[model samples]
Target chain A: MLYLVGLGLHDEKDVTVRGMEAIKGSERVYLEAYTSILGVGKERLDAFYGKDIVVADRDMVEMDSDEILRDADKVDVAFLVVGDPFGATTHADLLLRADALSIPYTVIHNASVMNAVGALGLALYNYGQTVSIPFFTDSWRPDSWLERVRENMRLGLHTLCLLDIKVKEQSEENLARGRKIYEPPRYMSVPTAISQLLSLLEDSSPSASSDSSPSLASADSLDPSTTLAISASRVGAPSQRFVAGTLAELSELDEEAFGGPLHSFVIVGRRFHALERDFAGRWAVDRERWNEVSNTVYAVRD
Target chain B: MLYLVGLGLHDEKDVTVRGMEAIKGSERVYLEAYTSILGVGKERLDAFYGKDIVVADRDMVEMDSDEILRDADKVDVAFLVVGDPFGATTHADLLLRADALSIPYTVIHNASVMNAVGALGLALYNYGQTVSIPFFTDSWRPDSWLERVRENMRLGLHTLCLLDIKVKEQSEENLARGRKIYEPPRYMSVPTAISQLLSLLEDSSPSASSDSSPSLASADSLDPSTTLAISASRVGAPSQRFVAGTLAELSELDEEAFGGPLHSFVIVGRRFHALERDFAGRWAVDRERWNEVSNTVYAVRD
Candidate 1:
């Protein structure tokens, strides 16, 4: 039997009781680490579960999944994911492989940013397709997510932008030299994501330099100064932080307050209800500033 | 502090270890009962946790939230939700009230059907805005969800149709008579939802009776015979069942196999990847029929 368990977004104790039971009964446990990072380390999880977990990198999970599911037909083998097992396609692929091998599997679900982002007070139903914003480089800058954001905005739906995190990645120089040296892990912060978005929007504007082609046709519709947005850091954690304001205000927020790793950004849509605005106001870094933007955007009722 | 913990989708053991701790340390624990139903009863949870729990219906949580939060600042109060704390807007509202009252709170995240639907092998990112289909009555038949389905289909995004569940609801006569009488709980089965959808579609067709006006402008975009869909019953439960096929094929599925309660439906969009098609094919009630529909819709990449 293959047990696909989700370690919910925080400490080791966030794993469901059923998941814990599955881990206890499993002969071998593998934690898929490339997709997302947890607040705690493997040693902490090991201490909590009273068993050592084999860390499965991208290569092992994507290329050699058979090894993870080896003898699963005979005994229980646990495959752990940071968020919900199906949040990423790779995890789903794990299930696919298990199915093809005639291995019975059980999925234990946990809270993921896909649903946890509702903490920012936006109705879950009001959210459209979620988009991931990757780090932009000089040579490989992509603006594909811009279209997704625009589609949500066009429909008056909130858009949850998942920031990119590069873990166990090798540098170009190291890769070229056939070196196994890896670069430090990098997690995109809200301010960094906002700056990248601003640059992209500016470059796409009609008044920008002639060499700069618009990445999105509806670029004119988004105004950074007036468009309300929310940024959350370390969601589902004890130290979770949320700041609600305009894109411009959020871009200039205090980094010391937001602190380290795992930040999510939400672009508020035009169809804001009075209740949503009221709820968002409670999380504002500057209540006065948030209300100013909210007044301009939200159609608040008495 | 107030602890809003999620009881992840299965039995009593589905609660996270952290959630259990919260409940253990809580002076008062109230389970929100109206938004979603859990597979287990209060007695089961009480027996597992060795703690007494008070069930908070919609009235208590929505109208008398202050009562639930009474002395919360002075004591450790646990408000348990079936899925993720923020899966429903009412839970978010509770957070708002708590915030307004300056009460500190912690959210324990758990798996929600929003992400758990990935069991069908569909990517979570590929799903668009979720729609809720309510039980249609003679005078209260609503087709608003049809517009949502149309928009998602237009964008080539999968749509998760959340079937409505009526619990502890009062009849109009009971309400007007100032009586506390409640109606028996009614959970919409997949077949019932599909039949209602089919009827709505047929009624809106131009070829139908002259008195019937088409609610959908692009009525031709959706065809029941060719559109692929998936239905799952008792998701996240030990006895969970999944059936995938074209809309027409699923509309006639046997209810005995689905059995008891808690069912969800999904409408496959136009842009299905080959991997998605292959994965979804595994749950097909009729593989040959599913493949026939898939080949016409999916852009297979081999």
Candidate 2:
């Protein structure tokens, strides 16, 4: 049997009781570490579970999954993910491999950023299609995700932007040279994401006609100063921080404002419910601006 | 301090270790019972947590919220939600109330149907705005939610339809007579939701021009026979079941196929990914039909 357990966001204690039971009963445990990371370290989890966990990097889970599933039909093997198992496609692919091997698997669901973002007081139902913001490089800057945000804004729906995390990544020099050197992990901060978004908006502006795609025609609809957004860091953790402000304001914030990694941003929709506004307003960078925008720009429903 | 802890879907064991600790340390534990429920009963939770839980119904949480927060400032008070605390707007309201009273609070996140639906293999990022399907009555048959579904389909995004759950509801007669008599709880099953959707589609068809509203002008784009959908019951529970099929076929399915309450429905959009198709294909009621629709109607991507 195979057990795909979820280590809910934050520390080792975030794991469900059922998940803990699965870990305790497993013959061997593997912790998937590439897609996302828990707030605690492997040492803490090892001490809590009383089991030595084999850290499975992206290569081990993606390229050599057969090793992870070996003998699963006979003995219980637990594969732990930082969030819900289905949060990333790679984990789903691992499950598919398990299916192909005829290994019976049980998934113990726990909270992921998808649902944990609700801690910011935005109704999950009001969110539109979630988009990912990748770390923009000077040579490989991509603004394709802007269309998703634009579509969400057009439909009066909030967009949850998941910032990129590069873990155990090989640098360009190492990849070409085949040298096994890995760069230090980098987590996209809220300020970086906001700056990237602002840059994309500027590039897609009508003034930059030479370098704009037709798909980004609707980018003009978004106004950085007037649009409300909420930047959350380390959601579901004890140190979780949320700041609601305009994109421009958030872009100007220092890294110290929202410490740590695993930050997420939400672009508020035009159709903001009164309750949602009230709940989020408590965390606003400027209460006066939040109130003014709520009354003038946003269409607050009863 | 007030602790809003989420008991993830399924039994008492679904609660996180941190949530359990909060419950154990709290002077008073109140279970938010009206919004949703777990697979196990209160007795099971009592046995597991070794604490008597006070079930907070709609009235207690809404009208009598002050009582729940009366002494919360002085001692640890835990308010348990079946899913994530922010899954519903009512919980957000409670948090706002806490903020208004200057009560310090912490939210322990857990999996809700919003993210748990990913167990069906569909990526959470592909899902659009969620809609709720209420049980249709002779006089109050609402098709307003269809527009949201249509918008999702139009954007090539899947729609997660949360089936309505009526708990501790009073009948009109009982309300008129000023009685406390409550009607039996009714949970909207997948088949019932499908039938309601089908009826709405029929009503909004071009042939029924006399009765349809102008807002439903794009209703013609939806074809029940070709549209793919997945019906899930008791998701995140051990007995959870998922069936993928056309709306018409699922509507004819027996109740026995998906047992119990807390059912959810998903309408697959035209932009179905190959991976999503493969994962959902495992539960297809008609494999041949599912394949044909995938090839002919759905624009599947790699």
Candidate 3:
């Protein structure tokens, strides 16, 4: 039997009881560690679960999945993933492979950012498609994610923007030389993402840059000086920090306020409900500034 | 301190270790009922936690929240919710109230359908705005949800249609008369939802019934004979079942195939990736028939 278990979020203790039972019942446990990271290391998990965990990187899971599924037909093998198992598409491929190999599997679900983002006080039902903002290099900058955020805003729906996390990535020279060298891990910070967004907005606004008319009308809806947003750092972690303010204010926010990796941003939509505003206001770095932006820009008079 | 803990989908064992710790530390534990239900009853959770569980229905949560928040500043009060604490907006209200009362609070996240739906092999990032389909009555049949479906389809994104569940609902007469009479719970089955969708499609088709033209251009995108769907019953449960087929075939699916309550439906979008198609095809009730429709309608001719 193949058991796909979720190690919710944060440290090792966040794993669900069912997931723990599955791990204890299994003969071998493999943890997928490339896509996301837990606050604590495998040793902490080993100490907590009282089981030896083999850390499986991207190459092992994507290339040699058969080893992970070895003898699953005869014995219980547990595959652990940070966050929910289905948060990434690679796990689905693993599940499909298990099905093809006639291995019976059980999925134990746990918390992921997809659902945990609801902590921002916005109704999940009111959220449109979520977008992922990748780190921009000198020559590579993608605006498709911005288009998605614009579409959500045009529909009066909030957009959950997932910042990128580059783990175990290789440099161009190392890749060309077929070397095993890896670059340092990079996690897109909320301030960095805001700066990218502001640059894009400025480039698109006719008054800011060259008067090349924008292709998307929705791009004009967001003015960095007026649009409100919520920047969340290390969501679902014990040391979570949230700041609510205008996009400009968020870009200039104190870098030390939000610490660590796995940051996310939410572009508040036009249909911001009063209750949502009230709830989010509690986390504002400056309540007066948040109200000033929200009142004129997001106030629902009804 | 007020602790909002999530009891993940299915049985009592689905609760996270952090949630278990909170329950153990709490002086009083209240389970929010009415929005969604756990597979096991309060007795099962009580037995697992070895603590008394107070069930908080809609009235107690919406009207008597102050009482629930009373003395939270001095005590550890655990407000348990099925799925993630923020899956429903009411819990956010409770958290806001906690803040108003100067009560420190912590949120223990768990899996909810928002993320669990990824088990169907569709990438969570590719899914657009989710829609809720309510039980249609003679006078209260609103098709606004169809607009959401159309918007997602237009964007070539999958739409997760949440079937409505009526729990402890009071009729107009009962409410107006100040009586506490409750209606029997009604969980929307997949077949019932399909029947409603088919009826709506037929009614809107120009060739069906009257000769009036359809108001929505996107209505043409969904054809009962060609559009594929996934009928999921009891998601996240041990006995969960998934059947994939065309809408026409799904409408005629056997009732016995999907037993019990809490069903959901997913309308496969036009931009079905090859991997998604292959994975979803594994669950097809009739592989040949599914292939016939999928190839002619959703074929990604790469």
Model 2, A188-270: lDDT tens digits are 99999988888887776756424343234343356677778999899999899999987877888899998999899999987
Local distance difference test, per candidate? 0.84, 0.86, 0.83
Stretches of candidate 1 off by over 4 Å are: A207-220, B207-220
lDDT of 1 by residue, B144-239 (tens): 898888888888788999899999999999999989999999999888888888888787775543333222323235677767899988889988
Fraction of reference contacts reproduced per prediction? Answer: 0.71, 0.74, 0.71
Task: Compute the DockQ of candidate 1.
Answer: 0.68
Q: What is the model-wide C-alpha lDDT for candidate 1?
A: 0.84
For model 3 chain A, where is the 10-residue window of minimal lDDT?
A211-220
Each candidate structure's TM-score, on Cα atoms with residue i matched to residue i, is 0.94, 0.95, 0.94
- Please identify which of the two predictions, 2 or 3, would achieve the higher lDDT against the true structure: 2
All candidates: TM-score of chain A: 0.93, 0.94, 0.94
Cα RMSD for candidates in order: 3.8, 4.0, 3.1
**Which is better, 1 or 3, measured by DockQ?**
3
True-vs-predicted CA distance for residue B92, candidate 2, Å: 2.2
Q: Considering the two chains of model 1, state its CAPRI-style docking category.
A: medium
Alpha-carbon DockQ of candidate 2: 0.68
Query: After best superposition, candidate 1 residue A11: deviation in angstroms?
Result: 1.1
* List of clashing residue pairs for candidate 3: none
Q: Which regions of candidate 3 are displaced past 4 Å? A: A208-220, B208-220
